[model samples]
Target: MLHFFKNLKIFAKILSLSTLLLLFVIIVAAYSLNQTVLLSDKLKSLSKEEIAFLGVANEVSTLQLEKNIYIERALRLILKRKFNESASFFDGSEPVVNKHNLQLIKKTTEGVQVGLAEIDKLVVNLLSKQWSAKIEKNIVNIREDFNKLKGEIVEFDAKVQAFFAASNISSELIEGEILQLERQQDTIDEHIISLMAGVERLTLDIIQESEQLESSAVKRTVIFTLVSVLVGTCLAFMIAKNIRVNLNKGISVAQQLSSGNLAVSFVANQQQDEVGQLLRELELMSQHFRKVLSKVTESSMHISQLASTLSNNTSDTAKDTEAQQSGIEQIASSITEMVSSIQEVSKNAHVAAESTQHADQQATEGHDIVSGVTESISTLVTSVENTSEVIKQLAKETANVESILDVIGSIAEQTNLLALNAAIEAARAGEQGKGFAVVADEVRSLALRTHESTQQIQTLIRNLQQQASNSVTKMDEGCTYAAETVQRATKAEASLKNIASAVNTINSMNMQIASAAEEQSSVAELINQSVEDISHKTQLNAERTHQISKESHDLSSLAETLQSAVKQFKTN
Candidate 1:
């Protein structure tokens, strides 16, 4: 029975229960209505038949009594006529006999006749109904008695009329007629008594039948009501218990899901009820969640491993960047020293040109001075060659720095891409990956900053390379001027007469060399400053790379944490 109810849909179950209760109510109502109709019919029967019979019978009895009184009065008048022999028959009581007494008797007999007619009509009506055999038999007996009493009343009335008619006869004749009328009256009274007895019997029988019908109606109504109540109560309890059990099962499954027990299972059934559908949906939801969490777990693990690898790579890159920055700083110091050396060469060239002017004033010391000038010019040439070589080396080193900057820029771009990928994965993880998303954003920002710094460094390196190329060009010009000064010094040594001219030319060349040397020194100073800026930028880049490495480690940690969180759900 429970299985049958369970198999039914929720609406069907409730409707079935209501229908049953309604059917029982309808049955009870119909039975009550039928009983009411039966009782109403019995009441109507009592009013129309038994009670009418009793009323007419009573009216008949009253008429019979009045007729009897009238007959007795007539009898007394006859007796009085027998006793008063001296008076005429129609003497003092003539008005009494003709007008009052006979008229009253005649009127009473007519009333009795009317009552009998009514009684006969009621009897015919009762017989037509075809009631119980016992009631019908009683009614038939009452009808027969009424007929007999009616015949007796007619005989008595005729006798009274005969007595009244024979008024001028003898007293003996009047007494004989009076005696006959008295016997007739006695017979009529006997029949009246029998008729009344039959009416009473029939009345009692109808009363008994009504009482039995009322008792049966009461007993049946109570029995049906009790049966309906018991059956309804049992049905309600069974339906409620079935519904409660199923609802409780659904609640249990929901509770399990709420508590994050993805491993919870629910058995499916063929029931098409609302609760069954809910349970099925919950089962599907649990399965879907389990699958999703399992995938999340695997993805988190992979992300963690990738983050770790990224962190390690980032750390190595940061170290390489730091080493590169240190090398660049050393190059900047070397360039500073080279700039100082170039300024010293410019000063020596000036002092050598002063010595050449002194040689023009003292011609006898001209040869020795020219020898000293030639040696100074040769040394200046050697210095210029050295400066040119240094400038070329600086340009080469600048090119190397540009290549390193390119590598750093590439690393920064790669880091940014990795951060972007991490952010995407974190987004895929939903609310669980909110913290990881924040970390990914931070990493991306750092990578962006690193990329910007790399770009700035590359710009600075390009400027430094441009400055180095300019410096190399200036150094080559200084070298050519030194070689020309050396040739002029050798010519001055061979001809004393043109020594003055040669000294002036040497002074002019020395001034030009000094100016070029000063310009080169300035360019070297600018180059040195640019190199320092590049070194500063490199340091900053290295620091950002280190930060990127740290962020990657944090990202790896976050991935591990996410994996751990997903592990709490027993998916698979």
Candidate 2:
């Protein structure tokens, strides 16, 4: 996609970037709105769950109030020896208990769930022991439990009057004072009332929490909307401006390229986009133009100098002979200087060849040493792997030994039980069982010894297990280190091979240099002999010297004309 965008037109690039930014904004807004809707629905559902929880708490409170009332009536009836009525009222509590099965559990909080579970258990426990034939006796046994919260009979009477003042208990009361009954056993009524209050408080807390969370969600939604609008608008504007700025820069660089300003450095955006590609292409083109311009400038200067020198040297026929004589004398000295340079080149090539051969030798040695190290690491890795396997097997064997120890411990306990049974049987047989009793005692001692031995073995096995765990951890570390070392050594070997290949390439290039140097040296010797021969033949070319001088002037003039045309573009 990045490569494809690099070739896109500037207009298309701007459109794509704008579209992408707008799409991002749309996605962000949609997601924020989606989250808002989900949160709203969740809050609404929580409100419903809290209402349901409140209903359940109310049901529990109503059930507890009825139980306390019925228990009081039943106890009073028992006090009156009205057995039939007491039993009927005792049966009345069962329906209240059956109502507990309808738990309102949907979307309930943890606190609500726990409170309801506690209420269920408390109701079941209280119902089990509330009204029985030994109910008074049982209540008396747990009377000390209420001693901490113990109040006076007057206090109990006042609480009872207030309870009767409530509408539910007022209608359900038998025509007797229930204060005496509640005082007779205060703990049951107090515990049930506490549980009812707890359930009510928990439901209220959940409702309040839901309300606060809903408020927080509303605030977050508003803040997110404002922030998205602010950030999205700024980001879109900045991206559009950046594209336009870079496009202008690309146009300026192209204008510079067209104006023969090759010496001016090309400036463009460094982004991986179409404008950046255009800028980079302009930079490359400018560099090529600079190179051609530089060569043309040098050629122009050379041609101008050659033309002036040719025009001066070919002034007339007499001056041409003097010029030819001077040139022959200079060629002999130049040939001698070229011979000296060729010898120096041959010497340098020999030195380079020797250096490359030595480097190749060192590279080969490094390859061998790295290969050896890799092999050593590989061997160590194998040993570590085998040790790891052994350690794993040891761990398995220890587990099996521990299981066997458990079996032995169970067998020891059974043996001890059997020995005691045998001893009792022997004791019951009286005088004839005396010997058998002694044997039972011996067998009991044997079982005790076996139990003690199994314990010792278990302890030893535990120690062995700990040692095996430590050994396995160390072995794993060693295995990992060895594997890493093998990788490093392999990489070193590969690096050495690469170096060896590079050394061989250098050696081959050195050999070619030595060969080329030898060929140049031979050519230089031949050119030296030709220069000497040309100096001797200078007089024989005296008749043709005037024509040659005229031709040289014409050639120099043409070179200057060509050079001026090429020198128009700036190179620096």
Candidate 3:
């Protein structure tokens, strides 16, 4: 609408400029024709003026010649005394003479008046006779004056003749001038008429051309306006149609998308403009939406399958784990029992080792005691050798005592011979001699008892020496056995210590194995939990994929609707 107003303004300006140009052309043409008509009128007036001037110069020259002839005839007749004839002849020439005279009189009178007036007041004081006398005397005494007057007359005549001749020439010149003026007048009139006719024709032509130009301008404006409006209308309609189609499609797509459907297809309209590009883009978008929908559907199915597998696997794993846990508990209990048995064995071994150590200590002490006893026995054997030497000396001493007793027996036999002598003497003393014989017999009995006691004492000493030797031999044997026993016990104790160290190593290995088994069980439980979490995540993903598929289906349906709407577009 604004563009239309602007075009209208431009058209008004063009129209005003054209009108101004036409007015200027018409004014200039009218001014040139008016000047031509005025020149033609002035030329005709000048031609009439030339003709009148030629007639007046010819008539004045003829009157001056007739006056000269009449004067000469009257003078000759008067000189001959032919008064009557002269009078008669004068009478006969009267009209001609009078006519000339009158003309002369009139001319002379006008010259006299002008001269008299210039003579100041002297002319007014002079009488008619005086004037006449002045005229006659001047005419008689001044022959030179008369001659000069005659010459003047002649000159006047010559001037008259010259005027007449000039008049003839003027006639001819005026005739020629008149003829030229007439011709010019005729030519001017013809040109004026022609110019007028031309002006009329030009005016008509200009009017027609202006009208045609105005008509053409109006027609061009109208045609241009119409074409513009038509093109604009077509453009507006196409734009409005495109907008309506897009809006309708968009609204339909939105509605379908809100409802959630996923099994629709899209179609695009074809064109060769921006609308076509948009439609192609929309079609591509719809295709992509469909592809996305397909992928979403596939993903949902896969997730469902995965969820089912996870649930089944979790159930199986749980059952197997329970059985394995029970078995592990049994194993743990058995291991606990075994540990207790090992501990008991360790305590028993500790006690046995202590006892062995104690026995070994006692055996070491016994070895030292036996070693001292062997040394004491060795000293006892040396003392036995000394005792045997002492026994040999005592036997030598007893043999000597027996020799003294044999000597005493021989002395007693001699004494018995002496007693026989003494008995003879005692016969004299019969009672004293009987008492001495009885005392000698008692002394012999006492000596026999003492000898038996001394023999028994020597046998008791020999028995004491044999018992000391046997005691020393038994102590030496005890010492040898005690040293051997101590050596054996030390070796046995070292062996037992080595066995205890091996048992501790076995216990350490068992603990490490049990710890590793516990760690394996913990890892298995974590794996089971992870499997369950994976199942839950898969289910969530499936739900999301399903939602996306539904959205895509709705979009595809809307795209199809949009394509259908755009199909109605008009290009022609």
TM-scores, all candidates, are 0.50, 0.27, 0.21
lDDT of 3 at 458: 43
Which is better, 2 or 3, measured by lDDT? 2
> Model 3 misses residue 132 by how many Å?
87
> What would the per-residue lDDT of candidate 1 be over residues 420-454, giving only the tens digit for each residue?
99999999999998999899899889989988998
Compose the digit string of candidate 3's lDDT tens values, residues 226-321: 665565556456445545665566556545444443233345544434444555565566556666665555555555555555555555555555
Clashing pairs in 2: none
**Superposing all C-alpha atoms, what RMSD in Å does each candidate have to the true structure?**
47.7, 28.7, 66.0
Off by over 4 Å in 2: 1-355, 382-386, 425-438, 478-487, 510-572
Clashes of each: 0, 0, 1
Count clashing pairs, candidate 1. Answer: 0
Q: So what's the TM-score on candidate 3?
A: 0.21
How many clashing pairs does model 3 include? 1
Q: Give the better candidate number (1 or 3) by lDDT.
A: 1
Model 2 / residue 530 / CA error / Å: 24
What Cα-based lDDT does every candidate model obtain? 0.81, 0.66, 0.46
- Give the range of the ten consecutive residues with the poorest summed lDDT in model 1: 89-98
